[model samples]
Target: MRVHIATDHAGLDLSRYLVEELVAAGYDLVDHGPAEYDALDDYPAFCISAARAVREDREAGLDSLGIVLGGSGNGEQIAANKVRGIRAALAWNLDTARLARQHNDAQVAAVGGRQHPREEALEIVKAFLAEPFSGEERHARRIGQVAEYEATGTVAGRLEELRPREFPAAREA
Candidate 1:
């Protein structure tokens, strides 16, 4: 797999560690700038660059993924998701990380440099990298719904189409 990694100054150390781990694990690693950390350097530049590379490869029907990191990972995730084809997930634990790929087929994982310890973060990354999309019909359908929403900025009727055929106008509660 071609894995692209991008991180701001806050995540420089962790990002360096990940590059080493990824290489030892035998994956092609792409570093998307921020080679030298600068406190004034922006996060979106690296995150979006990584996302763009991954998105471009997917456009050509190639397999690719990305990891974007920042202090809290929120802005990084937000920026990565701006790429139309990028499904970036902010993963906090093993379950969320694995499920991000398994259910959402996420191409990019947004990890928080300050959220978890080094060991836990490593585990989360490993879990995310290891899991494969489940491809169950329901999961695919749900993912499609979300992707459509992201692309068009509007929810599809397919979702409302699945609502209960009949229901009381008012909630029982």
Candidate 2:
């Protein structure tokens, strides 16, 4: 997989560490970077660039993902998700990381550099990279709803269409 990564000054060291570690693990990496630590730098440009690369690469039929890091990861996640088709998730642990991919099929993961130790953060990223989305019908349907809403600004009659005709009876087998 091609991994595109970016971070602001707050996450510079962790970003460097992740690049080195992920590269050594045989994954192709693209660093959309600040290049040097600048305290006044903004996260939106870097995070959005990485997210856009992931979107473009995937659209071009390449397997790609993105990582955006910052002190708390909140702003970075928000920035990445601003891209129309990108699903960015804030993942703080192994389960959250894995579920981000499995449940949401998120293309971008936002990690808080200050939230975990470097090794732990690495583990979280690894979990995210390894989990495949569970392509269950409900999951696909929900993702479709989100995509539809994103493109059309409304889900319209989707809820009505998907509603169960009647609740299952409360009977014991």
Best by TM-score: 2
lDDT of 2 by residue, 28-96 (tens): 999999899999999999999999999999999999999999999999999999998999999999999
lDDT of 2 at 68: 98
* Tens digit of per-residue lDDT, candidate 1, span 1-173: 88899999988888999999888998889999698979999999899999999999878887788999999889999999998878999999999999999989998999999998877788888888888999999999988778778878767666566766777598687
The segments of candidate 2 whose C-alpha lies over 4 angstroms from its true place after superposition are 158-173
Clashing pairs in 1: none
Candidate 2: lDDT over CA atoms?
Answer: 0.95
Which ranges of candidate 1 are over 4 A from the true structure?
Answer: 158-173
Cα RMSD (Å) between model 2 and the true structure?
Answer: 6.5
**Which one wins on lDDT?**
2
TM-score of 1: 0.87
For candidate 1, what is the total of clashing residue pairs?
0
